[model samples]
Target chain A: MTTVISPPESPAGSPAPRASRGFTFPTRFLPVIATIALFIAMFGVGSFRYEGFSSPQTLLSVLVDNSHLIVLAVGMTFVILTGGIDLSVGSVVALSTMIAAETLRAGWAAPLVIVTVLLTGSVLGLLMGLVIHYFEIQPFIVTLAGMFLARGLCYVISLESIPIKNETFTSFASGTIEIGDYFITPSVIVALVVLVIAAVVLHMTRFGRTVYAVGGSEQSALLMGLAVARTKVGVYVISGFCSALAGLLFSIYTLSGYNLGAVGMELDAIAAVVIGGTLLTGGSGLVLGSAVGVLVLGLIQSFISFDGTLSSWWTKITIGVLLLVFVLIQRLFTRRTT
Target chain B: MRDLGLRFVRHNLFWPTLALVLLLLLNLTKTPDFFSLRLQDGHLYGSLIDILRNSAPTLLIALGMTLVIATRGIDLSVGAVAAISGAVACTYMAGSPDESTAGRAVIGMTMAVAVAVLLGVWNGFLVSVLGIQPIIATLVLMTAGRGLAMLITDGQITTVNNSLFAKVSTGFVLGLPIAILIALAVFAITAVLTRRTALGMLIEAVGINPEASRLAGVRARTITWTVYVFVAFCAGIAGLMIASNTSAADANAAGLFIELDAILAVVIGGTSLAGGRFSLTGTLIGAMFIQTLATTIPTMGIPAETNYLFKAVVVIVVCLLQSPKARAVLSVRRSSPLLTKGSAA
Candidate 1:
C-alpha cells in the first residue's frame, strides 16, 4: 500500500504544476463545484428540451422521485469515506421495505413497524461491520454476503409484493406541503434532514473526521491514536441505519414491498456518488455532492421519459459514461494536487 | 493418523472438495438414487453428470476469475460480458437466412466472441493504460454492457432456431456432454498454457508486488492486459453455452449473478482475494460445489426467495472458516504456541 503520489515539496516554484493549478480551482472543492455545474446544466437542458419541464413542480418531483437515493448516497458517503463499501445497502433497503410492509400488514402499529425495520437494518450492518473488523475479511466480501442474506430474508418474508394498508403510514406517505408553486412530501423532508445531519456530522464532528482519517490511511490513523476500529464499525452502522430509513421511504413511495425492488439501486447510488465527485478509492468526498449526483441521475431519467422514444436503459449508459468522466477527472485532480 | 488428518485439512483443496463430496452425499441420502448413472442413447444421465454439465458456465467464468483475481483485479463485468455475447450470437443467428446451418452458428459465435474480446480490451485499456482502479474500471462496463446487449437485441429476448446451436449445450460427443467437454478443454488449454510457460509465474509475480515486479524487469502491464482479455474470452464461451442451453438469449437475465457465483467459487477454492497464488483445480471443485448446492436447494423444501439467504449463510461460514483469525482460534491449543498472538483480532 505505497502512496502512489505524495505532495510536492515546492508547489509554488514548479512551472508545469503552476500552469495546472492556475487552470484549476482549489482541488478540494473542484469536484463538488463541477458536480453542481453539471447538475444545473443537465436540469437546464431538460427544462428547455422537454415539454412540461420548466416548473418548480418538476424540480420538486426530482427530489421526490430520488428520495431513497439521496438517503442511500449519504450513507454510502460515510462508508466510502472509511475506505469500506456496503453492497448490502440495497438489499437491506429491500429487506427493510419488506419488513415494514409485512409488519404493517400484520396488524402492527406504524411506530412498531418503523422501529423493527430500522433495528433490522442496524443489526445487519453491525454484524457485517463486526465480521469485517474482527475477522479481518474484506468489506466487499462481507457486504456481499450481507447483500445475499438481506435479499434472501426479503424473499422469506413474502415472495409477492405486500401493499401497505396501514392508515397512519399511508397518510404520512401521501402528506405533502405546498411551497409556492411546488410541493414537498414528508419523505423528502426526512431525506433533507438526513442530508443536513450527515453533512454536519461529516464536516463538523470528531467521529466523521475520524472516518476520513481512517480512509485516508488506516495505519497512520492507528498510529495517531484514533479509534480506527470503532469508527470503521460505526460508519457501517450509520450506513445501515440510513439504508433502512431509505427503505422505509421507498416502501412509502411505492406503497408496496417486493423482493425484487431496487434490483440495482445500490449501483445507482454508487454511480451518483462517483458522478458527484467522490473518489472511489476513498478519502475526500462531500455529502452535498452526493445529493447533487442523485439529482443529475434523476434529471437524466426525467429527460429520457419526456423524450418518449428512448428506452430506460439509456440512463444506465449515461451514468456509466458520467462515472468514467468523473473518475478520470478525479485522477487528474489528485495528480495535480499531490 | 493425526498427522495425515492435519495435512489433509490444511490443504487448500480439502474444504472445497470436501464440501463437494458432502453435498453429493447429502443428495444421495435424500434421493437414494442420486449417484446412479446410466447410459441414455450413449450419453451419461444422472445427478453426478448433471452437476458437471450444469457447472460448465460457472466453471468457465471461475477459471477466468481465478486468473483475474490472481492479478489483484476483479472483472465485475463478466456477467454483463456474458449477456452481450449471448445477445450478439442470438441476434446474429436469428437474422441469418439459413439459421439451421452449423456454419451460421459458427460465424455467429465467432462474431460474438470477437465482440467480447473487444470489450475485454476496453476493460484492459481502462485498467492498465489509464490506471483506473480495476473494480471501478470494470464497473463501467458492468453498468453499461447490459444496455449494449439490450440495444443489440432490440429490447427483446431473441430466440434462434438452430439445432447446431442447441447441440453446443445439449449434444454429446463420444458419450460426453458437449458443455462439460468444452469446459474441460478450456481448463486443459489454460492449465497447459499457463503452467508450461512463464505466464503463470509472471502473473503471480505481478499480483504479489506490481512495483517490485516492474522494477525487476517483468512486463507487468502486458501480463495484466493479457489476463483481462483471457477472462473476457472465457466469459464469451460461457455466454455461448448459456444461450445454447436455452436456445434463446434474454439480455436482461442471461448470466445474472454469475460474477458473484464465480467469485464465491474462487474464494471457496482457497484463492486469496488479496491476490498472489491461485488454484485452477480448487476453482473447479468450488464451481462444482456451487452447482450441487443449486441443485440441492430446491429439495430442501424452502421457498425460492430464501435460496440466496441459504447461500449467503453457507458462504459466510466457509469464508469465516477460512479466515486466518478463525483458523488460529480453532487450532490454537493444538500446535502453535504463539497462536494467540498470531490472530490479528
Candidate 2:
C-alpha cells in the first residue's frame, strides 16, 4: 500500500521537493472502496424499482444460488494471481460432477465418492502442471487441452444426465439452518469457509509467499531459491481440487450431472477474477476480492432477472464491460505503483 | 553430400516428416484405401485432398496467426472477426437479392473485407497505442464482435443463393478446387511478403526485444499494429470461405472454436509461443495434418463424438514435441548412441 517515490532525474534547477512527491495511496483499500460504491449503487437502484430487493431472503437466495460459482472464482483467483490461468475448471466441474453422480448411482459411499472426485480433479491438474512444467509448454495450451479432454471424458462417462439419488447430497444441498425468517444454505457456508481458508493460506503460509514471488518474477523467485516449478504446479493442483469441490457442490445443488453443464463457466470465473481487481499478468490479488466480485456479478444477474425483460445474454455483455473497466483500472494502478 | 545429408537430418522438417510418415503408416494398416486418389466431377478427390480442403480456412487463419504469434502477441478475437465478416457478407447479399450478380457479390465481399480490416485496426489501436495487453484488448472485440454480428443478421442464419459466392468454396478452377487454389494463393502471398521483404526481419527483431528494437529505430509499435490488422483481415477472408462452403451464415456457430484450431496449426508448424521466429510453409502443412487427422478419425470408424478428444490428443502431442525439453531429449537420443558405441569399442 505504501508508495515510494524516486526523485526525477533532471537538472538541479528543476523543482526539488515537487519531483519527489509522487501520488501515494493504499492499494489494498481500492477494492474495498469500489465494493462499497458498487453496493451503494445497486442498493439505490434496487430501492428505486424492486419492492423486496433489499429483503434478507432475496439477498440470501442470491448468495446461495451462486455459491458454487463463488467457489470456482476463489480458486481461479489463486491461479490468476500467479499469472497463470485454468481454462479447464468448467469442464473439470462437469467431469467431477459426472463422476460423483455416477458413483452415487452405482451405490458408492458418499465419503468415498467425495474423496474420489477431489482426487480426480487434483490428478488432472497435476498432469497438466507436470506437462506444462517438465515440457516447458505454455499454460494456455495445456489448459486448453485439459478443457477438451475433461469435457470429452464427461461425455465418455455418459452422454445422458445422471441423476443423483443419494440422500446425503440432497440433504446437504436442500437443508438450511434457519435464523428467524432468513436462512443460510450449506453451500453458502462452504463457500465462506473456503474463502476464509484460502485467505489464510494465501497470506500466512510459506507456499503462498512462494506463489506471489513466482508470479512477481519467476527468474527472481528462482534466484531467491523459491521452488518455482513446485509452486506453479501446486497452485494448479489447488485449482483442480477447488473445481472438483465446486462440482460436488453443484451436483448437490442440482441433484443431477449432465455433460453439457458448465460449458462456458470458465469465462465467467475469469471475468469475476479480473473484475475483483486481480492482475491477469499475475502476482497481486485477494481471495476476498474475488468473493466480492462474485457477489457483484450475482447481484447484476439478480437485478436483470428481477427486471424480467432483459435476456440472459446481457449477463455476458455486462461481464465483458466490467472486465474491460477493471483491466483498465488495474493497468493504471500498476503504472502508478511502479 | 555427407554434410548435406547431416543438414537435412538436423532440420526441424525432418522430425515432422517422420511423424507424418508414422501416422500414414499407422492409418494404412487399418484402412488400405487411406491413400487412394480418385477423380470425380472434374475434380481430384481423395483423403489427402479432402483434408487439404477442410483445412483451408484453418490454414489461412494460421498463416496470419503465425505472424501475430511471432510478435509475442495473441489475437483471441480472430474467431469473432470471422463470424462478423460472415454475417456482413451474408446480410449484404441477402438484402440485395435482385442486384446484378457481379455487383452484389463484389460489393458484399468488399464490404466484408473492409469491415474486418476496420475491426483489426481498432484492435491494433488499443494494443499498440493504448498499450493494452494483446489478450485483453482482443477479448473486448471477441465478446462484442459476436454480438455485432448477431445484431447485423438479427440473430438468424442467412442462406446465400449467389452462385459466385458458392464458387469460392465449391467451384473448381483448372482441375483444382477453388478453395485449395485460394489457400495456395494466400500461402504464396504470405510467403513472399514475409520472406522477400524486410517486413519479416523487422517483425522478428521487434518481437525478440521491443525496447531494444525501438532504440534501434525499428518502429516496433507500427509493426505490431500492422500484424494484428493483417491477421484480422486474413480471418475475415477465411470467414467468407467457410460461409460460402456451408451456404449458410450462422454467426454463432460458424467460427466458434476456429481460434483454437488456428493456434494449434501455428504451434504444429514449429512456431515458438515466446516469439521471434515463424514458418508459413510449416503452418500450411500443419493445417493439412490437423484436417487429415480429423477426417481420418471418423473414417476409421471411431465414434464421431470423440473428435474433440482426438484433436486434443493430437494437439498435446504436437505441442509436446515442440517443447524445449522434448527437443533436447530428442537430440540427446540421437547423439548418446554414438557416445555409447565409441566407449564400448
Candidate 3:
C-alpha cells in the first residue's frame, strides 16, 4: 500500500534512508491481514460446523454469489483511491442491469447488449465527473444526484422485474468449467480476472502513482504537474465501467432486472472497501484486500444463514460493527503517522 | 437607480429567492389554491405552514449541518444518530408510563444525546486529532450507528403508548405545531450560540485554513469537536420529534436519507461543500424550499415516486449554481464591462 514511500527528510546533515525501514510493514496492511485472518477463521468454523462448507461447491457458490459485489468493489477502489466516491454505482448497476436485460429480451446480440450497457454507464459517469471536477461541486452531491437520475431512469424503463429470456445468458450463467470435481463458474473467473487487472493498474502504472499523488495532496500533485482533472475523470469512468460490468454479471446470476435490485448495495460495497483497509480519504488501499473483504462479508452472511436462528439483519449488524472497528483503527494509524 | 437594482439582483440571495419564486410560480400554475391561507383551530394553515411543519426535521438537521460544513466537514452519521435517538427514546418510553417516567424519557434522551455526542466526538477526534478524513470518520458511524439503533430496539419497531411523548410532536402550543416550536427554538439557540460567540469565527477559520488557525492558537481541534457534538445533538432532537410524531420507533426507516436531504438543503442554502462560511437562515429557507417542492408535487397531481426524481434535478441545479466555477462565471458575467458599455453607451 505504501510501497512508494516518500523520500525521507533529514533534519541534520546526515542522509536518511530513501525508504524508512522502521517496522517495514505499511499501516494499511493491518486491515488486509485482519481480513485474511477472519476469512481463514470463518472457513475453519464453517467447515467444522457444516459438512459441505469446505467443499468445492461451497467455495464456488460463495464466489459466484458475490461476483457482482466484487466487481463493484474493484470499481469503487479506483474512485476512492482518487479521493472521490461514486454513490450512484448501485443505481447505475440497476439501470445497467435493466438495459442489459431489456436488450437481451429484444433479441440484441450479447456483444451489443454489453457494449450499450457499458457505454451508458461510462457516459453517465463522465457527465458526473465533468460536473464535479469542472464545476468544483462535491463528489458526494454530484453522485447523489446521479443516484437519483439513474434510479429514476431504471424506474422509467420498467418498474417490474424484467426477466432475461435469452438462452445465451442462462447458459453462460449456469455454465461451469469442471476440473476433476472442482468446478469454476464464469462469474467467479470474471471477478478474479477483474481483480488481477485492477490490482495491476493500481500498483504498477504511472497512472496509479498519479492517483496516489492526487489523493495524498491535490495541491502538491498540481505543483508536481500531475493531470489532476484527467486522473479524476478516469477514476469515475473506471468506476462506472465496473458498475456496468457488475450489473451485467448480476443480471446473469439473478436472471432478472428491477429498479430496486441493488438498493443500498453501494453502502455494502463502501463498507467492504473500508473493511478491506481502503482509506476513504484515499492515497492507499489494495484490490486484493477488497476481494478478501467481500469474501469475509459473504462468509458472515453464510455463517448467519447456517446458524438458522439469526435473521439476515445480523449481517448488517456485523458489518456495522466491523466498519466502526476498522474506522477507529484507521483513525489511530493516521494519528500516529501524521 | 437601474444600476443599483441590477446590483441587488446580482446579490447572493437573488438566486435562492429566484429559485424559490420560480418553484412557487410553477406550483401556482398547477394548484390555484397554492397561495390561499386560513387559520384553523388557532393555527395558521396554509401551504407555507405546511412547508415549515414538514421542513422541521430537515431544517434542524441542516442547521446543524451548516456548522459542521462550515468547518469543511460533513456528517454522514446524522441520519443514523437520529435513528438511534428515536430507538432509545421510544424504547425507554415503552418501559415506563408514569409522569416520573417522563423523566425516564428525559434520561433516555440524555443517554441518546450522550451516545450521539460520543459518536460525534469520535468523528471529531479522528478528523481533528487523528487527521482521518471527515468522510471516512463519519462513515464509520453512519454504518454502525444504525445497526446500534437496531440492536437497541432488537431489530424491531417499538410502539410507545406515552401521551407526553406524543404531545411533544403532536400537540399545539398557541395553535402552532409543537414540532414547529421546537424547531424554531433549536434554530434560535443555534443561531445565537454561533453568532454571539467566538465559535462561528473559529469554525470558519479552522475550515478555511486549519494550519493557520492552529498556528494562531485557535484550538481548531476543540472547535471541530464542539461542532460535531452540537450537530449530533441536533440530530438527536430531530430523532425525538420523529419518533414522537409516529409514537413508534422504527429503527430501520426513521430518518432514512435524512442526511442526504440535510446535505442538499445546506448546499442549496449556498454553504460551500468545501466549507468556511455558512448561513443558518439560508439553510432554513433551503429546507423550506425542499419541503415546498415535495408538498407542491403531490398537490399538483404528480406521482409521489417522481418526487425523488424532481428533487434530484432541483438539487443538481442548486449544486451547480453554488459550485465555485458557476459562481465565478456568474461573477464575471455580472462584472464584465460589456454590460456597463451597453448601458452607458
Candidate 4:
C-alpha cells in the first residue's frame, strides 16, 4: 500500500506541472463526461415518459437494487485498471454466499460466518495471484481457472439454494435508512463506502498511482522502480475482497444462496466498468465513473419496467450497444493520450 | 535411435496423453467395464465411444479455439455464438413442418452458419480494424449474442421434430458417430490449412510479434480476421450439433459455458494461452479427457456437481506443469516448452 511515487512531490510552483495544467483536460475527461451526459439523458427520458419515475425513491431504489453490482464494479475497476481482468468475481460472489449460508446453518455466529466468507475469497484470490505471478501466466487464463475453482467450490458446498434465516443476517438485510419516502438499504451504504475508500486509495494514495502506472506499461513501471508484481497481485486481492463483500450484500438482498445465482454477473460488472468511461485496456478510469455506469444499467432496467413492454433481455443488448460506443470513444481518446 | 526415442518421450503431448490415460483408468475402478466396447444396431457403443460422442461438439469448438489462440487472440463469444446458431436453426426448422425433410434441415443449418459467420465478421472488424483489444471486442458479442439469440427464438426454446435434423447427432457412419466424424474432419482440415500451408507460420508470426510480422509483409490483419471467422463458423456447427442432439434450441442454456470447456481443452492439449505453437492432436486428447471426467464423476457415485471442481483441479495441474518455475522446482531438465517450440514468441 506504500506509495512509490509520492516522494519528491513536484513543488507547487514547478513550471512543468503549471504549464500542462488543464491542457489535456478535454480529451482526458471526455468519456466520463459523455457517460454522465448519457445517464442524465436516459434519466430525463424515463422521468418524462413514465409516471412516478422522477420521484426521489426511484433513484434511491436504483441504488438499493444495484448495490451489489456497484461493489462488484468497484472491484472490477481496480483489476481492469491494471490491464488485468478477473473473470472470477461473479463465481467468488456465489462461493461467498454459499459459505455464509452453510456456515450460518451449521450454527456459526454471524460475525464468524462473515469473516470466514471474506477470508475464503481473499485466499482463493491470493492463490490465483501467486500462480499468475510465479508461472508468468497470462492474467486472463489464470483468472478463468479461478472462475472455475470458485464456482466449483460453490457446488461442493451445496448444489441447492440455502436460505439464511439467522435473525441478525435477515434483520440487517431488511434494515433501511430513510428520509421520508426516500430510503436506502444498509447494502447501498456499504457499497458507497467501498466506492469512496477505493477512490481515495486509487487517487489520493501512492498505491493508486502505481496501479495506473502498472496498467499504463508494466515494463516502464518496473524501470521506474515500482513494484509491478505486487501491484498486479494486490489488485486481484482487492477484487476478491470486494466480490466477497458484494456477495454479502447480495445475500442480504435475496436472503438465499443459490449455486446458479449471478451466473453472468461478471459481465455486468465489466460492462459497468467499460460504460463508466474506463478503458478496457486499463490505466485510465475512475471509480466514480464506474458507479455512474452501474446507474446507467440500473436506469435501463427501470426504463424497461416502466414501459412494461420491453423484455428483460433488452437490458443486455442495450448495455452492449452503450459499451460499444464507450469503447470506441475510449479507443479514440486513448489514441490521443498515447 | 535412442536420442529420437527420448525426444518422442519429451514431446509436448506426453503429459496430457498420460493424464487422459490416468483418468480413463480411474473410471475402471467404478465401471469395471469402462473400456468395454460393443456393436449395437451397427453402431459403436461403450463408455469410450460415449466419451468421444459427448466431446464432439467441444472438440470442434476447441479446434477453432486453438487457431484463434495461436493468433494471440481469443473468442470468448463462442458459447454465445453457439447459442445464436442453435436458435437460428431451430427457429427456422420450427417455422416449417414438424416433420421437416432433409432440405429443411440443410437450409436451416446453412442460414444458421451464415448468421454466425456474419457475427464473426463483426468481431473481426472490432479487433482487426478498430484496434480494440480482443477480449473486450468479442465481449460485446458475448454479452449481446444471447439476447440476440433470445430475440431470434422469441425467448422460447424452439423445438424441431425433424428426423434428418436430429440425425446430425443421432446418425452414424461406418459404425462411428456422425458428430465425431464431422469434428475429426474439421480437425484434419484445420491441420492441413495451418501446417501444410504458410498460414500456420504466418499466424505464429503474428502472434509472436504483430508489429514485426506486419513490417515483414505479413497480412496480419487479414489473418487475424480470418481466424476469428473460422472460430465462429466452428462454434456455429457445434451449436447445431448440440441442438440436433436435444432436438431443441434452449437459447437460455444452449452452449452455456462451452467456451470455458473449449479453452480448457485447448490449454490441456499443450497450447499455451500466450498463443502460437498449437497441437490439434493434443486438443483431441484434452477434449476426450474432459468428456471422460464427466462420466467418471457420475460412475463414482459422487455428486455430479463436483465436475467443475475436478476440471478446476485438472486445469491448475496442467498449468503448473507447464510453468517453468514449477519445472525448476520439480527439477525437470527438459527445455522450456516456450523455448523449444517457438522461441520467437
Candidate 5:
C-alpha cells in the first residue's frame, strides 16, 4: 500500500518518487509546506505592518544584500544533504577576501587572482576531504581545523582590513541590472546561477542522486557499486568552492577584506538551510528552500530595522523560535513515518 | 612489563602532558622567573598562577563537556548560557540600590545558577525526549541565548559595582584564585561521581552504542539527558566567573567563543568526538595546554595574533597522530620484522 517508510527512501523525504500517492502526504510536503507557509505569513505580516515593505524593490534588495549568504546556504545544503557539515566556509570566505584584496593591491590581474582564490579554496577542501575520508577523522573536527587554519591564515596575511579599490572589482560590485523600477546586483545573479546549477546537479545527474543514496544508506549505496569515496569527498570540495566564491562576492560588496569578516556566518548558513526545510539528518531538502531561508533571515533583519524601536537582538530571538518550531515539525514527521 | 611500557607511551594523556610540559619549559626559557611565585598582599601571584586563573572557566566547561561527549553528544549552547548567567547576575546587581551588599550578591548568584540549571533542563528535554541531534538542539539556544541575555540587560552591557559579587572571580582562598578553586571542586566532584559509581560505565556503554546499550537494559536516554543538563550548569558557572572578572556582562561578547575553546580542550585532552572512552585528566592538561599556548606566543616574541595559526598546526599534528590510519601504519612499521630491528630502537 506504500505506507510511510523509515530510514530509507522506500519513502525517502524526496518529493520525486511520491507522485502517485494521494492518501498520504507528498511526504516531503510537510516540511516544504510548513516553510513556504511560514515565509508567506511573515511576509504578509511585514507588508501589513510596514509601509512599502511589499514593494518589488524591497524584495529585490533582500536578494541583492543576501547574495553572499544565499551562495553559502547552497554549499551548506550540499554538505548537510550528505549528513556532513562544513564549518570552514565562513573562515574560508574571510581568507578569500583577504587574498583577493592583497593580491589585487599587489597588481595581480583580477581574473588570475580570482582563479587563484577559487583554486586555493578547492585545494583546502580537497585536503580536508582527503583527511576526512582517508584518515577517517570526523568532518566536524576536520572542518573545525580548516576553519582555524583559514582564519589563522587570514591573520598571517594582514592583521587589519585591506580595502579593495581595484577598478574591475569595484565596478562589478557597483554595476546593477535594472528591471523597470527594481534593480538587482551582479552578486545576486551569480548566487542564483550557483543555486540553479546546484539544484540541477542534485536532482538531474547521477552523481547527485548518488549523494542522496549515500546519505540514505552509505552501505547500500556502496553495495550498489556507487563510488562512495569520490562523492563523499566531492561534496566538501563543492562547499569549499562555494565559500570562496561567496568570499569574492563579499569582498566586492564590502570593498574590503576585514580579518573578522563573516564571523559566525557558518551558523547563519546552517540555520537558513535547516529553517528552509532541509533535513539536518541528510537525505531530504530543496535548494530553493535554502534560498528562501536566507530571505527569511534577511527579512527578519529588515523587520527589525524597519521598526526602529525594536532591539536588534529580537531578530536572533525570532530566528531561534522559528528554528525550534521547524525542527519540532521535522521530528514529528520523521517519527510518524517511522 | 615491557607491554606496560608501550601502554604508557600509547596512553591518551602522554602527548598532551608532554605538550604542557614543553610549553612551560619554553616559557621558562623566555623568563627564568616565569615560575617564580610571590606572596603579594597575602595572595600568591605569578605567570603560572595567572594561567590557572585564566583557564579555570575553560577547564570547568571542558569537565562538563567531557561527560556530554562521553554520551555521544555535544553542547554548543555553553557560550550562550555563559553569557546568559552573567547577564542575569550583573543585571540584578546593577538594579539594586545597595549594589555592594553581600546578600544581594548571593541572591544574584543563586538566581543566575538557578536560571542556568533551567537552561540545562531545556537542553536535556530537547536531546532526551525530542530525539534531536545534540549539536542542532543546543544550537537553538546558542543562536538565541545572546539575544535572551541582551534582552535581560535591556540590550545594554550590564556593569555592576558589587565588591562581594566580584569576589567570585577575584577573591583568593588559601592563596589560590577562587575561580580555580570552584573549577577544581567541580572537577573533583565529577571525577568522584563518574569513577566511583556505575554511572560512568553506563555513560560509556551508551556512548559506544546506544541501541546495544538499550538492549542491554541501560537508561541511555537518562544518561544523555543528565549530561546535557550538567554541561549547561558548568557553562553557566563559567559565565558568572567571566562576568565577575570584568565586573560587566557584555551579553554579546562575554562568552563569545569560549564554547569552541572548551570543546577544543576536551578534544585535545584525548576525548574522542566519536564518544565512548573519555579522560578528565586529559581535559585538564588540554585546558592547561591551550591557556599556556595563548600566552606562549607573546612571550616568545611572536605576534600574539598568530596564536590561532600555531594552534591550527598543533591540532592537525595531534589529530593526524591519533587517526586510526596513521596508527595502523605506525603499528605496521613496528611489527614488521625487518623494519623493527634497528628502526624500533
Candidate 6:
C-alpha cells in the first residue's frame, strides 16, 4: 500500500507541461521567490514600524533565538521534498535534550554524549524508515508512533527537567563570535554550518536528485534505477540527525532539558518548510527557502514582542494564516500547471 | 459450528471487540467490582458506567470522524475546533449576568456550534473547492484554532459556574449519564441517517474514487462539505461536554491530543486511512477500547507520567496487527498446509 506520497493526479490522462520557464528562473522558483519577498516585506515593515527592528543586532538576535528551528526546518525541507513528513522530530528533540542533560549530569564526556545522542536519533529514524518502507505504513502514522515513543521515552527519562552543569556545554552556550555590534553564538554557528551543508547536498549531490525524483514519481524513479527506498529512508535519517543536533543546541541554549520543551516544534518546522516554499506533496523546494521561512517565523515573534500590547498567541495565529496562504498559493500553482 | 466461529473471528469487528473484552476482563481481575453496577437514586455507578460516561466525548467525536474518514478526508482540527467551541461557550456563559439559566446555556451552545460549523465549511471549501490536500487544509485550523480560542478567552481559562451548564454533562437521564445518552443519540442518528439513505453509499463511492464518483453524479462536493460540517458540530458538542465537566475552559489544554485519539478510534474500528468502506459500530468499539485503556493504565499501577509509553506500544501493536503485511504472513502460514489438501480434491 502506498502511503503519504500520493501526488495529486493530473485532471486527465493528458499530463501538464513538465518543462516550463519563467522570465528568469524556472517556474518552480515562483513560490520561493514569493517567500523571500514576504520575508523582505515583513522585515521592511518591522524596520519601518519598530524603532530598532532594522538594526543588525536585532536581526542577529532573531537568528540566535531560532537557530534550532532553522536546523529543524532544513531537515524538514529534505523530508517534504521526498513527499514524506517526520512528525517525530519534535519528540526526538525533546528525547535528545533529556538524554544529553542526564548524561552530562552523570559526568559523561561532552563529545561522547553528543555522538551518542546523534546516533540515537539516526537509529530512531532508521527504525521508523524500516517500518514505513517494509510495512508500507503511512509516514504520518509511522512518524506519529515515533513521536509517541520518543515523547514517552522523554517522560521515562525524567518527568522533571534536568539541568546541564557540564563546563564544556556551558562554555559552548556562552561562546560567541562578534561581528561589529552583533554577536553570534555557537548554536547559531552550528545552525549556519548545517544550513550550508544541507544546501550543498540538496542542490549538488546525486542523492539529492534522487530525493526529488522519488518525490516526483516513485514509479518513474524506480524505472530510472534510482534507489527510491534508500533515498526515502535517508531523508528521514537526516531529519532525525538534525533534530538531535538541534536538541543539543536547545539544551545548551537553555542549560536544561525539560520534557515540555519543543512541544509542537515539529509543526513549527513544518510551517517554516512550507512557508519557505516547500510543497507538502514534495518534489520541488530549496533548503535556503526553508531558512528564510525560519527567519519569517522569528520575525513574526519579534514583531509580536515589539508590539507589547499584543498577546504572544498572535504569533501562532499569524503563522497559521501564513501557512494557509502558502498552501493556497501552492494549490493555485498546481492547478494552473496541471 | 466451527465454520460459524471461524467466520465470526474473521469478521472486522471481531478483533476490536475481543480487545475491549480483554481490557474489561483485566479490569475485573484487578477489582471484582469493576463489572458490578449499582443504582444510586436515578443514576448508575460503577467502573463500567464511568467508562461509558468518560468515553462519551470521544465517542461523539469519533462518530463524526468515521464518516469524514469514509470520505477519504481527515479532520485534524477537531481537537482545536473543540477547544474553540469550549472557549466560545464558556466565555459567552461567563459574560452573562445570569449564567445559570437554561436559556443562556442554550444561546451559548448555539453560538459555539455555529462558529464550529463555519470552521467546518472553511475546511470543506479548502479541500473540495480549492483542491487543497485535506491534511494541510485542516492543519491550518488545527494550528490556529487554539489561538483563536485563546483570543476568545483573552488568554485566560474562562470558568462558568452555571448549574444548567453543569447539568448538561453531570446530570442523569433515566439512570444514565446525560453525556452518555447524548452520545448514544448521536450514534443512533448517524447510523439511521447513513444506512437509511443513499448518503452512506455515495460517501463510500466518493472515498473509493472521488473523480469516478463525481462522474457518477454522486455530488462529491456536497457530501464532502456535509461531513466536515457534521464532524465540526460533533466536536462542538464534545467541547461543550468537556468544558461543562470541569466548569472551566483552558484554551491551551482543552481538547489537546484528542484529534489523535479520535483518529486512533477510527483506525481501530477498521477504517482504512486510505479511505473506503467504514464501520461506525467498529468505531464505537474502538472508542470504548481507548477509554478502557486510559482507565486501565492508571489502575494497573503504571506511573501517570510513563503511561503514554505503554499506550504507544499498544497502539503500535494494534496498528501492526491490522497491517496487510502482518495479515499476509499469518494467512499464508495458516493456509499453506491446507492448500495441498484442497488441491487433492
lDDT of 4 by residue, B31-131 (tens): 78889999988998988888888899999999989988888899999999999999999999899864488898999999999999999899999999999
* TM-score quality measure for candidate 1: 0.95
Per-prediction RMSD in angstroms?
2.8, 4.3, 4.2, 4.9, 3.7, 3.5
Model 5 DockQ class: medium
Q: What's the TM-score of every candidate structure? A: 0.95, 0.90, 0.89, 0.94, 0.95, 0.95
Better of 1 and 3 by lDDT: 1
i-RMSD values for every candidate model: 1.0, 1.9, 2.0, 1.1, 1.2, 1.0
Give the higher-TM-score candidate: 4 or 5: 5
- The residue pairs in collision within model 4 are none
lDDT of 4 by residue, A248-285 (tens): 88888999887888899999999999999888777888
Which candidate gets the maximum lDDT versus the true structure? 5
Task: Name the candidate, 1 or 2, with the larger DockQ value.
Answer: 1
Q: Which one wins on TM-score?
A: 1
* Candidate 5 ranges beyond 4 A from true positions: A1-25, B1-4, B333-345
**Can you give the lDDT of residue A276 in candidate 5?**
88
Clashing pairs in 5: A9-A12
Candidate 6 regions off by >4 Å?
A1-17, A20-24, B332-345
> Each model's DockQ?
0.75, 0.49, 0.52, 0.66, 0.69, 0.66
Model 5 per-residue lDDT tens digits across residues A179-280:
997899999999999999999999999989988877777777788899889988999999999999999999999999888999999989999999989888
Candidate 4 chain B least-lDDT 10 residues = B331-340
Chain B TM (all candidates): 0.95, 0.91, 0.90, 0.93, 0.95, 0.96
Clashing pairs in 2: none
> What lDDT does the true structure give each of the candidates?
0.89, 0.83, 0.83, 0.89, 0.89, 0.89
Task: Return the top candidate by DockQ.
Answer: 1
DockQ of candidate 1 (2 decimals): 0.75
Segments in model 3 whose C-alpha atoms lie over 4 Å from true places: A1-8, A11-31, A45-52, A102-110, A177-184, A219-226, A332-338, B97-115, B328-345
| Model 4: CA > 4 A from native | A1-27, B1-5, B332-345
lDDT tens digits by residue: candidate 3, B1-345 = 999999988776677777788888888888788788888778777776677677888888888899999999999989999998889887776767552356776776777677777777777787777776777678877877777888888888998777777777777788778887888899999888889997888889998988899999999888988888888888988888888888888988899889988988888888888889888877877888888888877777765556768877977888877776987778767886887567667
**Mind giving the per-residue lDDT tens digits that candidate 2 earns over B254-329?**
8877888898888887888888998887787778777767776666787655666876787788787878798777
Model 1, span B1-345: residue lDDT tens: 999999988888887888889888887777899988899889889888888999999999999999999999999999999999999999999998998899999999999999999999999888888888888898889999888889899889999999998988998998889998999999999888879998888899999998899999999998898889989999998999999999999989999889999999898888888899899998998899889888888766667567788779877988888789877667776766675667635
- Which candidate, 3 or 5, has the higher DockQ? 5
